[model samples]
Structures are given as structure tokens and as C-alpha cells.
Target: PRLLRAAGVAQVVPPLAARDGRLHVPLCRQAGGLQLAVFAYITGRGGADAPLGREQWRQFGATLRAVHQTPVPEPLRRALPTWQEPGEVGRWLQRALPVWRRQKGRTAAARALIEVIGVRYDELQALTARMLALHQRLGERIAAGELRCALCHSDAHVHNLMVDQQERVWLIDWDGASWSPIERDLMFVIGGLSADLLRPHETEWFFEGYGPVQIDWPALATCRYAWAVTDVHAFAIEALGERDEARASSSAAWFERLFAPGEIVALAREGEAWL
Candidate 1:
């Protein structure tokens, strides 16, 4: 939050420090074993349900560009992690495929996901293989110093954006911040991952605020494919590996949506042509 504020981002909810002057505090293990933290609440309205107007979308684009362009000081840069190959999907495929093949689901949602997997298993396998291959190639390029890296708000979806009372757009959710290809964020905006948020024609307004950008298609394709694979792994875990009925039901719905006609899986497949 301080980094973005220093960069002159329109707005950011600064994190409040704890008694020790640390912004993040640890929670009890029973409470999920995650860190606890709080931020200065912004008086704004924003969420997945609150669709942005074209101008607001443009502002969001500019805000993201500012984040990407912010320089990381040497000490902080050394501490921040660079993007790594996504592994959850491969792990899920290894562990879950056998159970799915046997149709040994423990819950209704699990059964539904298993049934869908039974029908589309080969397609899923092929896509995972392709995504892994793309990531390998990108890694080679990065090693050869052919790709540029930048600070990224890696999960800059509509749900993480806010529109303040002053009409300025604020970016929230810095937990996923990392050093990555700029395409890591751009994939959501101009690269079809955000079809639910901005139509293709309306993306021009975003560019209007962002100015001209030279897109690296291969990098964008990798990001899109990785996103689909990661999302599938996440929802599958909830649907098949958890006992919460309501959460499982929601996960099952989201898992099905990933393969819907115009959804993330399809978008990732469409991106394969860019490679």
C-alpha cells in the first residue's frame, strides 16, 4: 500500500501497523494458520457485482499501469518472489485422476466434478501438457534475458478494484503482489481473461488511458493458460477434497463454469493460437 501510494496511484487502503509495528500478524493455527492484518477502510463501492463504466475501466487500466511501472528498491526487490511455474494442476491431476477414474467421489459435488472429468479427462490432460510446455519455453526466454519483468498485482480482477466517493479507482488486495511479466496482469484486461468484465470493443477505452502497449502474445498466452489451470485446481480441491456442503456446491458450479463455452478454459484454448 505504501509503495503504491508513493507511486501516486489514485488510491490505496494503507495497512495499519500492529503493536510491534508490523503490518501483518500471525493468526492461531486453528483459524487457518494464516496471517492477520487490517487496512484503513476506504469509503467506496466496488465488487464483481458492481460493473465499471468505460471510463472507470480506463482508470483501472491506468492504475494497473502505475503499479507495473513502480520501481522496486534493491532490498525489497531481493525479498520479493518472481513468478514460478504453476504446479497445483499437475499435482491435482496426479492425485485426483485415479480417484476420479474409479468414480469414488465422497460428496454430491465431488460426484458431479468426477462425472464431468470422466467426459473431459483427455482434454484436460492435453491442455495441462500444453500449458506446462509453454511455461518451460517462457522460462527459457526469461533466462536468456529476452523478457522484461515488473511488479505485478497478479490478481487484479474486478473484485479487487474499488471506486472511491471521489470517483477515483483504487486497487485493493496486494497479497498476490510479485515480480512477474507485465503480461501477468495484462492477460486479464486485454487478453480475454476478463471477458465477463469488459467486452472486446470496450477494451479500447482502457488503452485510451493506458497509452500504447506492445503486447507479448506468447507471454500473455502462458498467463491465460496458467490462470485456467490454477483455477481448475482450486475449485476441484474444494469440490472433491472438502466436507463443507455449501462451499462444495459453489465450487462445483465454478468448476463447471470453467469449461463453459465462452469461459476461461475456452479462452485459454483460443490463446494457444498465439503461441
Candidate 2:
């Protein structure tokens, strides 16, 4: 956050410091045992479902460009983790599939998992395999030092973006920040990866603010598939592991939505053509 502010990324809402002078002070735990932290509040209107106008999309593009262009200090560079291919979905499925197959589906969570995975397991496995292969190719490129790394907001989806009263586009959620290929951020913009939030012309307007640059197609494809794979893994975990029924239902719904026509799964598969 400090680095973004220093780089003139005014869209970032500065966190309020706690009594101990720490910005992200951990507070009480939620029912799910997740630690809650407080931060500076911004008066904004946009949310995950908010429709962004052309200007808003352009500003979002510019703000993200600023974030990617921010220089990483030596200490920060060393501390930040580099991008890696996602494998949790594959691993989790490998371990859970056999168990799920054998279970009588007595528990609600077990039933939910079985119902979600039973029909789509093969499709999920095939997609994961394709993504893993793409990642392997990406790994070779990384080893050959063919890609450039930048500060990236790895989860820069619509939910993480907001528009203030002055129409400034604010980027929230920094927990997923990492040193990754610029494509890590770009993938969410160019493809339908923004969940179809930005129209085709709006995407062009976004590039107007972002300016010209060469796109690393291989890196972009990997990032896109990685996001899909990671989301699948995360939602499946929430559906099967979350004790709260409401949360579990929400996860299951999102997991189902991922496979809807022209949704994330199809979008990710479309990325293979770029390879």
C-alpha cells in the first residue's frame, strides 16, 4: 500500500494504524476462525456487480498500470514471493475423489462435494491437466529468463475494485499482492477474465489509458488458467470444509457458476489457443 501510494497510485486506501503503529492489526476471529483486520474506509459506490462506464474502466486500467510499474525496493523484492503454477485443485481432487466415491454422503458438506464433483470431475481433471501442461511450458520460459517480473495485484477482479465519489477507481484487497509477470495482471483485463464486466470497446478504452506494450501471450495464458484452477480449488475447499452452511452454499454456487457457458472454465480453455 505504501509503495502504491509512493508511486502516485492515489486509488489505494491507506490503512489506519493501530495503537501498536501497525496498519494491519489482527482483531477478533470470525466464526470460521479467520482473523479479522480493520482498514481505512473509503466512501465508494462500485462493488463486484457494479457496472463500470468507459471512463471507470479506463481509470481502472491506468491504476493497474501504475501498480505494475511501481518499482520494488531490494528488500521488498526479496520478501515478495514469485509467481508459481497452481496445483492445489489437482492435488485436492486426487486425494478427495477416491474418498468421495466411497462415502455414503451422509454429511451435508460431503453431499455438497459429491454433488458438485460427481458430474464434473472428469472435465475438471482434463482442464487441470491442460493448465498444468501450460504451466510446465511457462516454467521453462521462466527458467530461461524470458519473462519480466512486476508488482502485481494477483486478484484484481471486479470485487477488488471500487469507484469513489470523485470517480477515482480504487483498488482494494492487497493480500494477493506478489512479484509476478506483468501478464499476471493483464490477463484479467484483455480476456473475458474480468467476468465479462468490461465490454469490447471498454477494453479498448482501457488500453487507451494503459498505453502500448507487447503482451507475453504464454505468460498471460498461464495466469488465466492459474486463476481458474486456484478458484476451483478454493471454492471446492469452502464447499467441503466450511462449517457454515451459508458460506458453503455460496461457495458451491460459485463453483457451479465457473462451469456455466462462456464462464471462467470456457474462458480459460480459450486461452489455450494463445499458446
Tens-digit lDDT string for candidate 2 (1-275): 87789778887876666788766644555555554567677787754567777788878888888988888899988888667636545566556665654554434764766776877778877777877777777778877899888899887767788877887788899887888888988877777564555457867877887888899988898888888887887777677776677777787788888888767787887887888
In candidate 2 the C-alpha lDDT for residue 243 amounts to 69
Q: Indicate which candidate wins on TM-score.
A: 1
- lDDT, candidates in the order shown: 0.80, 0.76
Model 2 CA RMSD to the hidden true structure, in angstroms: 2.9
Query: TM-scores of all models?
Result: 0.91, 0.87
Q: Judge candidate 2 at residue 24 and give its lDDT.
A: 60
Candidate 1 lDDT over residue span 1-275, tens digit each: 77778778755677888998998887987888799888877787974657677888788778888888888898887777666736445556656665665766778878878888888788878877787888888888888999999998888877888888877778899887878899998887765664676577557767777778898899999988888888877788778886777788899899889988778998998987899
lDDT of 1 at 209: 73
Number of colliding residue pairs in model 2: 0
